[model samples]
Target chain A: MPLPAPSPNPNPAPPDAGMSRRSFLRTSAVLTTGLAALAASLKPLLEMNDFPTMERFLQKYYKEMTPEDMEKVLKRIEAEVEKQYGIRPHVRDLKPMDGVEFVYCLNLTRCIGCRKCVHACVAENNQSRNPEIQYIRVLRLPHGSLDIEKAEHNYAPESVPEKGYFYMPVQCQQCKNPPCVKVCPIHATWQETDGITVIDYDWCIGCRYCEAACPYWARRFNFTKPSIPKERLNPDMAYLGNRPRRQGVMEKCHFCIQRTRVGRYPACLEVCPTGARKFGNILDPNSEVSYILKNKRVFIQLKEELGTSPRFFYYFDV
Target chain B: MLRLVLCTQPRSSLVAFGGSARMRPVEGDALTRAGDPMNSQTRTTLVLTGLILAFLALTTLFISNLPGRPLRQPPIPLVNTNFLDTATVRRSYADLVRAGEDLSDFDCYACHEKGKPPPLRYDTNQNLIVPKEHSDIVMGHGSHGRNNNCFNCHNETNLELLQTRDGHEVKFADSPSLCGSCHGPTYRDWEAGAHGRISGFWDRSLGAAERKACVNCHNPHSPHFPSRPPAPGPHPLRPVATASVEPGPNH
Candidate 1:
């Protein structure tokens, strides 16, 4: 009886079995809107100036790159710098030398706070002229107080060594236990074997956690596109040093990595008129930094309580 | 729901507060009964339309009354300043003597006759008169003006050489040794690369580390550092001028 005849079907199939006109129109409308929304969401990426080429975008981490890879990367960087600055830069990847540990010593009695080091660093590092990024900040502190919170970094006295104050030029401490390195989620910055902390600008995602973590306020973030005058741009650049940094990267005092790794004095140290700044290999017993550390009596690190064990030492000539 | 019912019904018809009362259907109420559904609906529609129109009108007025957004100005480029004068800061007497450049500035024989020392002249106050030939030299070597005698640093026997307190003659480039006779500790520190600036390789095997002589930074006549205008302060990204102090005299 059940197979006798098929009762009149409740609903008949349409001519187009796969999809009806109304459903097709609805699906197309949803998909089109979705695709348009997706495109709109991704619009801001087009404004990024940092990732100019695929080679730069896909560059390996600093430690992961071999010498061959570094050569290619260095050449690419040189080309990019030349294209932007109108001068061919000698960008070399200088590795740390064996048995050399860098250390910096500042003589508090001698520093006059002329800020020559500050401008010299800007000039040597190819820092942005308009925005004016300086690695060194000369703080004017009262003689009676060691309070850094009360220190004035923007004092523009007619002359330095102001009557009741002492000058302390603060930069990256290059701590043995660096908080900035610890806070870098992407491992963009790390201390080298030679005791200088360096940043791989390409690997940095610009989260700025390291900036927040630095107790010395050393790390500087590039908020705008960095612009250096072509004539003033420093052509001698290193992979981890003063290569022209892009818009959204972090940079700091790398102990003049380009110069220091190749057995040259840092630009800041060379420019200091008072001879307050001293840098040398601490491992060498005869080095000046070692002499200062051993002989100078009133030695102090800026923030020694934090256990950063800063490589920078400040001493008085009592 | 309770608020809607209360709004729709007359005030007297409610038995309890909104919390205790159960919601009722909004369809056949006293307000609906008092007038035809079409008339009531038309009134509600007119009220809603008027409210929306008022809101939109107020929003437009408010927006128009608001102050205009301030346009951000681009940062002015820093002007060229002669703050990093390396020639003045890093002058090495050794480099000058080695290069055999013009020594007229420091040459005693250029002004004074060779093999004859200029007579030391003293003013009424016993301050060295610093003869007209060397009038540019400001004598402020000692804090108390006790060591201002020309003979204290100048060699009387030979005009070309400088003499230490112990009578040892020194070349112009080797004047640091002469300075050591008086400033013993400072001289020691300088020899150890602690007192004066060194501007070359830290590692000696790789390159030469040029140590600036004592006279390089300090004028031998006036040992005190002269006051001068510092480099310009930082201009941060926020656009606020952090340094309120204006540029002053470079003395």
Candidate 2:
């Protein structure tokens, strides 16, 4: 433009300068590669994501967080969910009540293979509808056969009571010695005092160690970001229970902790058509579950083996 | 050409370094490439590391804050009820136990005053308790072809009350006692809260539970429980081979 800056020579090296074209080009290649490799390694730190990344990274383990910290974190989560789904969730860290160890009992004879409990659980728990995350899988077993493997989960027919079949709905056993809790690398999951196992959704790295550890196949992982419509979202939520989970988290039934911790019946028990399901505090001698355990021929899924000591009991009437 | 390029880089730097050992700018460039991961002092490396660290922090923040799409709830399917028939009863215990709650208050004499009643016997099918006068009252309970006489379970004297096997008068609400006379072990299990269904508070301290009586789940006319359509089965996650004749050893 002005004096026409001297054109920078594209190939500056000459054979007379005692430098080869190979040397000149080689230097350029190393510098470019070195810069790129460094950038590639930094991708994890540099990549953008949707969660409150910095805050999540520095978050303390659930057991270690103070009550004040918990309240603050809850507010932050509420804000995040609101921004994303347009529904402001009431997330609470509900504590277990005194002298209440919850127990569940199901009467196999009365169950008519109706899958109402399974659907009720899904709606109440904010379970992912697509890719269908169901917490309860009712096994339709042949008559006189207690083997769960022989049971068919996909036996939906034109009608039920297909002659020789008895139904047993399987869910998270809430085991006293839960293997899922022991296998969690991030301590994202643990047992509550009320005998319900719960997970901190934000803290789970989605490694799926807990899923493999569970004998009941009771856990589900969010492969993609959950897409709950704003209209149907259950705003009433317990932090460890049915709060809308984000992407890359593991979840399962928590016995409707959001409801049961407050002395309300679980959704599954409420929707049972045949009254096949029962739930109560084990400590209370007069509770229905205790009555079933004491008077009925109560059995567990894996009693002698696995030593999981499940709070769930399955029994057929005498 | 590729081999020449690969082989020449280090040699160029070496020769360039040797030729310009006293040159400050040339020495500075060499030091930077060597300084990374060794001494954390070079300005470019420090700046780049800081940028990388910040980028990571920003990345984590972005991911954690990304909007999660809310899942649309799958439309709940209404179960076909006509097929369910007698095999299932959706009503709770109190609702069923309260079947004929005002039995003591009801007077059957209002409809059937001291008049000549129709013949209590069916010609061939014992279950057809339908008197010609009450053609709408079609009884199907005699499906077993036995116990067709009206007075078999009912009291001849009282039209409003049921009679137990011991000839004792029983209220309609207390049908379990009459049913228990024949089903002894069933009654025992029912009393122990086993055979039928129980709903409401499990803790009696909270509220009294309602237990279903025998008649609540069975049609008295046709005692043989008819098969009905079940509630929708679980959504198949994969091809279920377990439905075959046998999948594993019987537990």
lDDT of 1 by residue, A13-99 (tens): 443445534334333544554565565556557767566688887889999999999999999999988888789999999889999
TM-score of chain A of 2: 0.84
> Docking quality tier of candidate 1?
acceptable
Query: How close is candidate 2 at the interface, in terms of C-alpha RMSD after superposing the true interface residues?
Result: 8.7
Clashes of each: 0, 29
TM-score of chain A of 1: 0.87
Off by over 4 Å in 2: A1-49, A53-60, A74-90, B1-5, B8-111, B114-118, B125-143, B150-156, B204-216, B223-228, B231-243, B246-251
User: For model 1, what is the alpha-carbon lDDT of residue A36?
Assistant: 55
Q: Each predicted model: what fraction of the native A–B Cα contacts (within 8 Å) does it retain?
A: 0.50, 0.27
CA shift of A245, model 2, Å = 1.4
lDDT of 1 by residue, B1-251 (tens): 33233333322122212233333223335547768867765654454445445555554544444444334657656645476555555355677777888767776666678767678878888888887767888989998788877778878878667898778888777889899999988888888898888887888888997878888888888888766778877765465655333222222
DockQ list for all candidates: 0.25, 0.16
User: lDDT tens string, model 2, B27-110?
Assistant: 455665575635623343354445455556655554454444344546644334332232235332335445645432245677
**Quality of candidate 2 docking, DockQ:** 0.16
